[model samples]
Target: MLSMAIGDRIRDFRMAKEPKLTQEQLAESIGIKRSRLAQYEAGRTEPPLTILKMIALALDTTLPELEDEGVPVPRKTKAVQDAPMPNVPQETVDMPYAGLVPADSNWGDPLGTGEELPVDIKFKGENRFVCKVVGDSCYPYLKQGDIAIFEVDPGPSVGTIILAERLGDRACTVKLLEWDAEAGRSRLKPLNEAYEPPSSSPGWQATAKLIGLEFKHEGVKMTAIEPGGFRSRQLAWRGFDI
Candidate 1:
């Protein structure tokens, strides 16, 4: 079962390092704040794949080994003679992430990251945001480990799948916005029968319309282009969700 919390996996891998790196050590190595790294380890926040990928690199392990509960990959790879180098993004932003929000996580006000992560520019726009998927709530349409891109639309039309949040509860969920003509309102509908529909409260509202989704992979992020780090990996979302 993929039940292990990602935070725990990060902590385990950090400690399992030969030198047993401290939060400060790891954070420093990755160019992030120790407090931020602390939140990831403590579960106060979910680290997006961009951040998680860096963590994997610093810990001398693969991203899958840290994020997946499937078979573990061996750590301490001594050579990569036959392996292709990782594709690190040059022009990057600390793109906000929303889950594709964890299925079990409940958030508090301001929705930091808004639930956001760094994304490649193809998905960038004034209203677009990237979300890392960690649950099977969207099932066959949007699988776990898929990174979904959504366009901010506070009023997405009925029948559109959306990333929504309940202001009163500060909870985020992905579902189809269904029109209930009889009730003269809309309700969230679950496409997959295995999951329950999202809560419908007065504060419940659409935040963005689902647009794109891609399988997750390890890639470094940089705000500025580094000399000699000019390689690019232009991956399009496997399919347009909308």
Candidate 2:
């Protein structure tokens, strides 16, 4: 049987790579089809020992690390290539457009939705703020058009998906937060492998806390992005049980 846990780890490590190995690229490197890689990632199939070893090499990860069950598959703390920061709006003021708040803005108070999405008002608190996605770095799970609802300074734990800002970053980004107390650094893992992995140095501050995501789809609904770094809709529509 395909182990969902293992598959989840495989997918995370693939995305956590320095440059990120796409399904197609990783499959090609291992002499398999992209569909097979997708199946392996989705937990529909388990790869053979040989294929698994190849995957570890292709992702620049150790096979022992892959085989270890206790280890988090992507372990966001791992170092990867550095990427340029994205440009974000400097305005902290709340815009009139759909209750959208910029990440850099002072979001001490809850933003006004102005009757845009049918968000669960119960979750709206002083700590929660809504910020629009600025780039495609976290695609599939978080898109450019999607609006992110974040909780400010919640003191997130390891493997929490967050919308945070690094010291040298121009804007806040959506990433999986992994803390390394020994090294005094944090790794910000992106969902999209095309973009490079981001991390935090000393004096890193989370710009906003990622509570959930609001996607502008056919029907206006609220979905919490899972820590697995995939859209909740794709995972059998188990929306926002978190």
lDDT of 2 by residue, 23-63 (tens): 89889877899999898889888888878866765554555
All models: lDDT? 0.58, 0.54
Over 4 Å off in model 1, which ranges?
Answer: 1-94, 99-118, 201-203, 216-242
| After superposition, candidate 2 runs with Cα above 4 Å error | 1-118, 168-170, 179-185, 199-203, 216-222, 225-242
The C-alpha TM-scores of every prediction are: 0.46, 0.42
Q: List the lowest-lDDT window of 10 residues for candidate 1.
A: 227-236
Query: Compared to the true structure, candidate 1 yields what TM-score?
Result: 0.46
Model 1, residue pairs in steric clash: 95-117, 95-118, 96-116, 96-117, 97-115, 97-116, 97-117, 98-115, 113-116
* lDDT at 154, model 2: 41
- Specify the highest-lDDT model's number: 1
- Candidate 1 lDDT tens digits, 1-242: 22238878888777766446799999998889999988888888888777876777566455665776673533434232222323344454555664435444464332354555766555556656666765445544455555666677778777666777776655778777788999999888774555676655555767767765444222222121111111112111211111
